[model samples]
Target: MSEASIKRAALYRMVTPEHICPFGLKSRDLLRREGYAVEDHRLRSRAETDAFMAEQQVKTTPQTFIAGERVGGYDDLRRHFGKPVPDPKATSYQPVVAVFGMALAMALAGSWASLGDVLTLRTAEWFVAFSMCILALLKLQDLESFSNMFLGYDLLAQRWVRYAYLYPFGEGLAGVLMAAGALTWISAPVAACIGTIGAISVINAVYVERRALKCACVGGGSKVPLGFVSLTENVMMVAMAGWMAFRTWA
Candidate 1:
């Protein structure tokens, strides 16, 4: 086993029915109601848990610590316990702009494609599979966030990863729809779906900005402030959406 394995080894599952995150205590209570004994704070900290593992002789690989510091396992748990880490909400705004810009660029790409020779039926099918694939990849990176993206309200603040996954697939599908629209004038359905997705992205972006929360678009691009570049990108997406609508009907 690699050293990184030991860093977080066995930590993810250390929580017992009783020891659940306070944020998820309702579930713990429900589990108790269902008759499983749970601890409220069975595994308090990484040091505590690591000590338990060592005592139990749980074999784990060493961890490669660049800083040679033991970042507490159960960061999720810590966050739930209200320990202060960098506020995800305080991330740089630049990432927010970059993410939106990517979305807008995708929208334009799809609009331009709609004017191309791709078949509408083929494009729609493509859009579905392709978008789902992107979603899948995003989910692969972080399933909890993806779950929250579709269902909303992740208590863990996993939204940033979800946003990253949704952006590319959402925009890519929009572009594919545009291509199909030009060929068969039947890509409207796909365009509509893409538009709906775009609207959602816009909503997320607006909400982040309105809340004055920094963008958590970590995997999507560089960490920076939301700025003019982002605004320009969104304008392009608007253009793409408009172009798709026109070409699909025209």
Candidate 2:
């Protein structure tokens, strides 16, 4: 679009003594990014802000007008530009990604510090252990929420609701024991039982039932989808348990 034909946007945002409205700034930036010439209007006080809103017959500040037409707020501007707006209620894999990323980093750091190597069998073990610990921490943050989500797929949790509540603690304990390379007898059994039950649950939910659902792997509040990642977690635990048991016997 030519400069003359480019849309002109008017923005009114609060710049009061106590606070500067962040959305107002965002609106102005968004307008500029969309090739709009922004006419920035700052309301310096609560009273002034209120007056502008009242005069405009709008409920919120950071109001935008483009080419003499009211274009609503920041979210509206995004929609106008055909950009995907973030939804607060939406499910996402961000929590699981962050936890797993951190676990991998910690595993590498620990391996380098102790064994002077980052790629070794011990590093793999530490990675799984740390992942378990981190995942457990997330679930323990809101056990009730975790249990609710977990019961949707976990056979044991569905049959015995208390298992859902105890799941985090069990995972945490097993992780710690495995990390310490101590009490393999206890940790091995615990890991095996939970992993077996979890794999069965995931297989049934994702394949047999063909139910699309959110994963409780990160926590109850997460939007992480249930599927391959959940299955992998169970498989990892099962493998770890078997490894520990073999080491014990050897």
Candidate 3:
């Protein structure tokens, strides 16, 4: 579009000495990036902001208006521009995929550097250990949230509430020990116990009962759908635990 025929958008945001509305600035930037000439209007005081809000009949600031029509907030502006907006209620396996993908990539890179081969037993072992550690980290980020979410479907957690809180620590400890190829007696048992419980819970919740739910494998606030991916995680842990123990014995 030419300058003379350019589209225009008005963005009203709060910019006071003490506070600035982040959404307002984002909306203005979005409009400009989308080829709209933005008319920036800063409400410099609480009184002015309140009056503007009252006039606009809006409870929030950083409101956008395009083509002389109100386009709401930053998310609303995104929608108006045909941009994708994240839905909090939606189910997705993006986090799980990301954790597992990064773990595998890191494992492969390490194997190539240390053993001169990416496709090796060490790589497989490291991938599972890395995945466990990363997943544990995510859960440990919000222990309360993870525990609450885990209680929803985990039979062990449902029966013994304290297990939910300890699960992440156990997973992390086992992963570290396994990665170091040490203390197989302790790490292997911990991994096996947790893995067995997790596998059984996943099977009961997603397969036998056929209930659709979010997986707590990633974290409590995660949108990862509970199903085959979750099942695989538990099963991998169980298999890895057995393999590590066998390798140590042999």
Candidate 4:
């Protein structure tokens, strides 16, 4: 379409001495970006803002109207522009990603500081240990939530609820021992038992039963999905345990 035929938008927002609506500015900018000629209607006082809302039957300021039709508020403008609106209640892998990313970074830093190399056997061990510590910390943050989520798939936890609560402590203890390269007898067995149980539980829930669920790996509060990442964590623990046990015995 030609520039002359571009859509027109009307915006009503608060611009009082004490407050200026940020959404109003964003709406105006978005409208301009989308090739809309905006008619900015500023309400200079609370009374005027209230009056405008009442007249327009809107509960909020920063209302936008496009092509003589009410386009609602800032969120509405985004929808009209075909933007992806964020859902506050939605599940995401961000928490798990962030935790794992940080764990890897810490591992690299520790490796550089101790061994003068970024990639080594020690580095890989540190990565696994650090990841365990971090994941355990997340679970410990809200033990109740973690236990509840864990019980959904963990066979041991389902049979013995206390196991869910004790799991984090066990993970954290094993991680700390492994990270320091101390108490191999204790840490190795702890890691192996938990890892084996976790792997089995996850396989049953995800593959055998085909049950879809949330992961408690990051934390009870996280929305991370139960799948490959969770399985990888268990596998890492099992591998670490095996490595540590072999080193101790050999």
**What are the models' TM-scores?**
0.30, 0.79, 0.91, 0.74
lDDT of 1 by residue, 1-250 (tens): 6644432211222344445444334434433543434433445556765886586455331211113333233333344346555656454554444444454454455545764644444443444333333333433465444433433322223445455344545544554555344543434443454445434453565555343322222333224333333333334445445555665566
Between 1 and 4, whose lDDT is larger?
Answer: 4
lDDT of 3 by residue, 112-135 (tens): 999999999999999999999999
Tens digits of per-residue lDDT for model 4, 1-250: 8887878889998999899999999999999998888999999999999999899898998999877889999998899889988786688888878878998999999999989999988888888999999999999999999999999999999999999999999999999999999999999999999999999999999999999899899878767778888999999999999999998898
Clashing residue pairs for model 4:
none
The C-alpha stretches of model 2 lying farther than 4 A from their native spots are 1-54, 59-61, 65-69, 80-82, 87-91
lDDT value, candidate 2, whole model: 0.89
In model 1, how large is the Cα lDDT of residue 53?
58
Error of 1 at 92 (Å): 3.0
Put down candidate 2 lDDT per residue, 139-250, tens digits, no spaces.
9999999999999999989889999999999999999999988999999899888988999999999999999998899888878788888898889899999998898788
Candidate that would win on lDDT = 4
CA shift of 207, model 1, Å: 6.5
Q: What is the lDDT of candidate 4?
A: 0.92
The lDDT for every candidate, in the order shown, is 0.41, 0.89, 0.91, 0.92
Candidate order by TM-score, decreasing, is 3, 2, 4, 1
TM-score between candidate 1 and the true structure? 0.30
User: How much does candidate 2 score in TM-score?
Assistant: 0.79
